[model samples]
Target chain A: MGLVANAGDSRAAVVDRPGAVAVAAVLGYLVLDLVVKLSGISVFFLGMQVLGGSLELGSLLSMVIDGLLVGLAVGLAGIGLSMTYSILDFANFAHGDTVTAGAFLGWVAAYIAAGLGTGAPIAELFMLNSGRQLSTVSTFVPVLLGLVVAGVGSVGVTLLVDRLTYRPMRAAGNISLLIASIGVALAMRYLIAFVFGTQTSGVASGGLRITFFGTVSMTDNEVTLLVVSLLLMLAVHLLLQRTKLGKAMRAMADNEDLARVTGIPTERVIRLTWILGGGLAGVGGYLLVLESGTISFNFGWILLLLIFAAVIVGGIGSIYGAMAGGVLIGLVDSLALIWLPSGLTRAAAFLVLIVVLLLRPSGIFGGVTTA
Target chain B: MSQRATVSAEVTLPDPSERLLAIRNLDAGYGDLQVLSDVHMDVADEEYVVIVGPNGAGKSTVMKSVFGLTTYMGGEVVFDGTDISERNPDEIIYEGISYVPQTGNVFGSLSVRENLEMGAYILDEVPEDRIEDVYERFPILRERSEQDAGTLSGGQQQMLAMGRALMLDPDLLLLDEPSAGLAPDLVEDMFDRIDRINDDGTAILMVEQNAKEALRRCDRGYVLVQGQNRYEDDGSVLLNDEQVRQDFLGG
Candidate 1:
């Protein structure tokens, strides 16, 4: 009997270490995530809902899934953010405005497609109408069209920004660059508001909801968003880790002079970096609109702090760090209402960012610093 | 002192020669500031040619001008019969002129193998056989192929820089002060490796501050003063000249 008890106790001890580790990881993630949500001012509605005792297993799962999607979206945004840091070596203050511009373009393209009457080759393929019925495959069509429009808009804005603002500022160095970028940001904000009008717009059509596990229901838009974000993040990861162009980008970030000496066309690489970074921001804007069903001229600007916090927490110029940081920030922002007021969630992210900056200035992942 | 004599003896050996590289009246410098003024030099295809001088003698500027890093005010830089003065650095590299700067020379964040791959960036195609050949020459690099270049020792980093430049199988290699901050023993080993590099058929045009040692290893030597070539002679003749030895070599 003693032998049997001893064997059981030994087995229990063996299992306890892994269990403790898993629990610790989850709890740590929860606390960090809560801080981000509070910092972002998103915990108000969440607080009310939780206080009303309306949080059920199904609701919790749905919230978790929503948080996951947001995290993935932010991670995708992180790739673009990392690239921006590489090219300019400073936060492109106008980046959020560029995202809004892409969103506006996506909206315009969808509106134009809707007006051309369904079934015309271009109209039928690209249009998103409120009353239109979509088949399983057709559900994917609007998102793709949105992505294409956003990508083009992003590349155009990026080029323009480089020509008008970044190029001159780069020659002048850091402080002048910062001022110019801020000027571009403010100018872009007003420009987007003027063109798109000062009203909110929705990108998703009312569609059939797919129910899973007899309790979880998701719309076509949400599923589209989640899948698209995942695929894009995967593609970006592969591009940065596996390709020659990616290696060149890393090298430039490490040592620009050495990269130039090694035959890397520095100007071309800079252009490519802008296009890619701006394009990702554009996609993030479009995804946010699809998920929330509403977007305004200030959509990206409002999210700027959260995004900045994510990038900073992850470490500047580190793609993997950005992704991890984005997801972590997103989860916290989405779930903070569980324990705190909604208005304070966003600020929590900033607090965490401050702590990270103070403690580990190199960030969670050690970033490559150029001499 | 006896050990120094033996190392100097080890450096005096010579090999067969062919035309490696030639530069004529290479006037080049940064914007508005002339660093090299009408300097002329040559290295037989398989010869080691070292340019030695004081700190401000423009030795590095000479290498930079040849590699197209600096603008040439006038004169021709011919490498393998191609006039490269008008070409960009990458184009010059394609024309078989490889340059390794004095400091921060390697891409620090890249692995040893990646640095080597980047060395051959100008080539339309990279032959795997050449990589294996370089590995055979620097076995230490092979052991640390996956390690970052920045973590390597100064001497090891210099070797990696040279190995990277050789990846394109260039006919001529330009080195700027390879022994800049090495220990005495490491400097000796570095000179020996340079001699081996020359023996393997790449002509070397190097700027070194260690004048006596540089003069001991090279077939010919040039002394530059204030961006102009002041003296040129056979290595042994310069080593034996009283004035050359006193003024430059600190003998």
Candidate 2:
């Protein structure tokens, strides 16, 4: 008992060092935040101070805290997302689209439910019923419904891609597999555009806001997105770590031929992998739409670079990397807008990706090394 | 070699009995390359049959063809009264024949117990005591029940492969090079286990490179050269035969 306590103390001390470092980092960010705020170069500074920083500790701390939180989130998301790619050995280019689709579905469902109560037509409720307010229960109902709908969509697309593209190109080798994935990406892009149109559509209806610590305030939409993403991530984490199916999935990913000869039913395991991967992608898309308050054909496509950057930076096959990568990218993109031009923030995420790849090609977490 | 053969010709032939597995006029190969031709052999019930040949003499090919892993152009493999020449490997396994391949035969990533469980994957009900019985035979396996098969030594892996085959409770077990790459002691122990398996009522059709040792422990044996059956006799007769010893038995 004493030894365990000592070990726990050491671990806690290690954790505290990072926390202290984060505090120092945030303080440094606050200083930068103040310079931007005082210069008044852009009206965006007002929003930054309002949305991004703390007053007493300065903008440096705020920025650092922001970076750290974003890093942690990206790492977590990256870990979750990479499990799919690492296990399946397939790059799901349509994953971002799946997330957007889920968010869009949630938005549509919420709008419809709001509309039904107001006795408006379905089209008007979805398109222009901006005044209808939903109860908390009603607000969450769409999220659940959206998740299921998006999950189904993700699975369908994954199966379709497997049957139509992956299975055939697998024999053709890696280059062909890559080309097929590109083809799938293009098809998904055009299909989404054809169905949803190429314009940004507002999904969030009310100006719901909540304040935390007198400085950090979040909208209901943002809060929902964060909470749902975290919950989904947790569920996936448990699924991968605890279940028999999850063990089978990991075993299959580690060595497929071994799994097959061991009578693991490779086909079933493959199908389940696709389902889980697609479903997670769907949830990610839904969160994207909710947080952004808009959906367009190119939205997911535009976000693909950021998502890939997150997945790669965290680790190719490591699930923890995906989660960490997502939040890190989000926070970096958010904070990079403080210094660089808006157009350059997206490029900054990619830049981080390239630099990380150069430094550690296997990612922050190690990927499977092919002998 | 000729003088050695001439010195030991006074061996009598033993009568053949009820056939457990019979291969006739077998012509099998991989993609236009004829490896085995007109191969004829039979294993009787409760008998241990060993095939001895030099490397690349199509010994493994014979085992593979019987296990339905190789493509055969012309052949009939009757196992326990069923014609199984065209059957799939899994079907052959289900028809009471278990095959242990020469390389990568067991699941390396799985625990020893899991590998054994997989052996009985085709069966709806694998008796719990079968695992205990196998453990009793291989106490080392029981000690490392949860250890991955990859972590085991070569001899232990061979034992695990044999034990896995026994899990299915198959009537016939096909082993390809059971004694290959083993320490001399392990080889002798493996031969003894083969004898014990035969004693336990499972017909073993093994392809071995250890000609003298394998033949000495088997009930019957076959000598193959260039994929054709060159000689067939009781194990003891073949072990002492002058011509057989000179031509193929490494005399």
Candidate 3:
């Protein structure tokens, strides 16, 4: 009975304070183990091999690169999620489906543009598995057009959704709005599935591979994703830092009541928030497809958990926090492959999120808000 | 002060035609919770008016009602001969009035410059001259132009809030408890700044918890008790009245 009580107390303590010593021990062990494995150094305790595995330095480098690319996509999408959460004061569950919508809209445009002169039927192009090859190098114009369309089209969809569903309930409590968003998510998901069949398919042909430092290799699509995501991130930074509308957004996020009294058109700001966020999610979704060379109806929905994990870990309302959290979650998701199977990498990411929340409930950028 | 008091006794208020703002039979409050009932008040052009009251007396509610931040049950808020009781705050701002809330008035996470810029968000371009004027009035804000408002001391934050409201260069400015959270030393300095602003000819409507000090400084004062008007007189008369001093002022 005494032993049972002690176990229960420790369990309760983990929920309250979270055993810092235990967390540190686990983290230290993981680090030490990773280092040992990377260095190919074995540890022997009492004539028994306790730690070490053959992890190549090259493989680790590739993991980091892979993690960075995926992180950029997740981070880009997270910017919109974080903005809406901050400005709208609700967790929009439909955000993931918005991404899916962007991907489909952009991919359709790309396919139709690329197969324009080809004798292929319009339906085959719409199906996105046309016999004609398409890649960044082969179909640059089509890809560019697709990216633009993705952003603009998503903006339209978000605005319409807000007008039809959210605006009427603007004064409602956060829970009502959140639950309403969940319903929106379901409606959008099924609508997309109905319009574009549910089956996933490879859409892009592999482009040129660029080698970096004579050691690391990256695909042309990956490089494109890198440049575009970085440029868009910079644009976002400028918008938030230098523009009047952006400052109003930050101010509204800081204190809505004050914003209203200060004579800011709250409705206009809300519309702009959706426009900016929807645009980012749209572009981010298109770029993810560009990198992965595949398109699906539900990829965005599947990616939603990871996006949310990033947002919460970084701090819900902070843009920079979302970016940082996205990269961290992405790196952890990829790097965890070293120990766990690829299927379980998502689980590893969530474990890290749980640990992070237990350590700092507000997240890494909690107090700083939208700025 | 004595000579001014003698002149105020035979007071010739600016004609009602020149009144900048008039609140008649005002009834307003948060949804389902009435706070202000049949409240009547007025501010003449360039007039400096202050509202003083005990806690929960609806002084702030009156200010908010004028700004259209509260639900209007029945009232007429006329500004410059235009009925504006039905207008929203955004529209009211265009009518040449600006409001500075008692607290959370400044955008804490934004830079001082950004906070000031947000104040003029309704304008097509950033008015550099008005920004300069605000900086000239509050030199500390100029030095901390790029710093976030949240990092400032309470006194500095209050100054920033005032500067933000001044960005639009409104004809009438409503300030709610500008001295509420200031250190005792800073309160006098804050009141002096308001006096200077009013002296420059902008009509001032303020609600202050610092009754004695507010009454001493305003041209006219209104004593609101439990959401109803209790007294209206020249600041000097209210300050000297035995009943007013005993009940509202901590004599």
Top-DockQ candidate index: 3
Residue-level lDDT tens digits of model 1 in A44-146: 3644622122345566668677777777767666667776776557777787777788877776575455445544555333323343433224455555676
Taking the tens digit of each residue's C-alpha lDDT, what string does model 3 give over A1-371? 12223666767766665455467667778888899998999899999977778798778888998888888899999988998899999999999989889988998999899998888899999888775556788789999999999999999989999999999999899899999999999999999888878888788765788888777888878888889998998998898888888888889989998898787889988899999899889889998999988878889998999999999999999998888998999899999998898899999999999988987889889886555
Report the lDDT of model 3 for residue A330: 89
TM-score of each: 0.81, 0.71, 0.93
Ignoring the other chain, what TM-score does chain B have in each prediction? 0.89, 0.91, 0.93
Task: Name the docking class for model 3.
Answer: medium
lDDT of 2 by residue, A70-116 (tens): 44434433443466576667666656555555455555676776566
lDDT (C-alpha, whole model) for all candidates: 0.74, 0.69, 0.88
Tens digit of per-residue lDDT, candidate 2, span B58-134: 98898889887678799788887788888867567777888777777665655788667767765565557888888
Each candidate's interface RMSD (Å, one decimal) is 2.7, 5.0, 1.2
Chain A TM-scores, per candidate, are 0.78, 0.75, 0.92
What is the TM-score of candidate 3?
A: 0.93
**Total clashes for model 1:** 20
DockQ, computed on Cα atoms, for candidate 1: 0.36
**Candidate 2, overall lDDT?**
0.69
